[model samples]
Target: AMTVFAEKYGVKYLAAVKCLHKDADALLAFYDFPAEHREHLRTSNPVGSVFATLRHRTARTKGALSQKTARLMVFTLVQAASKTWRRLQGANQL
Candidate 1:
């Protein structure tokens, strides 16, 4: 279901799906899940552990991306380029 929704929206679902695995040692290591608990956690239920961690991390990362900054930069560049083009056209006319 999630994979279908992600596909429809062109979003990456690998992280979310991968979190469902009971033995995600590699991922837990990569994310720096505590060394002592890593082994025990491998067999533990991940519903409220890895799944929650992945969801929270992904949300934080996504939320931190500056969409407003990107839009402002694009708008500024386009406006400047259009003004320059119009000036060039006016000069050519004269």
Candidate 2:
């Protein structure tokens, strides 16, 4: 089930697995993601203009989701929305 979800989303399953083992570097390498992206993950901030949209979404939705599942769903949606906004703005440097 996890593999299916990862593959469907174009996510690196090895990275997700390595994350469970706390092997941060291996997980980053598995995704072929730049070290800068790791910084963004650590900071919980988008790399460019997406940051503004993410900030706005988080602020507007704070404390609205009481359940963990609902919060995760909201977060995923917000992330996708922010990415789309960044792409439309053509300001995604990473």
RMSD after Cα superposition, model 2: 14.8
Q: What are the models' TM-scores?
A: 0.23, 0.24
lDDT of 2 by residue, 6-53 (tens): 556545466675454575556447457555455545544445555565
Mark the regions of model 1 whose C-alpha exceeds 4 Å error after superposition. 1-65, 86-94
Tens digits of per-residue lDDT for model 1, 1-94: 5346446644455565555444456544644654544444455553454345445654766755477864665455455544533222233323
Clashes of 1: 0
Off by over 4 Å in 2: 1-46, 63-75, 82-94
Worst 10 contiguous positions by lDDT, candidate 1: 84-93
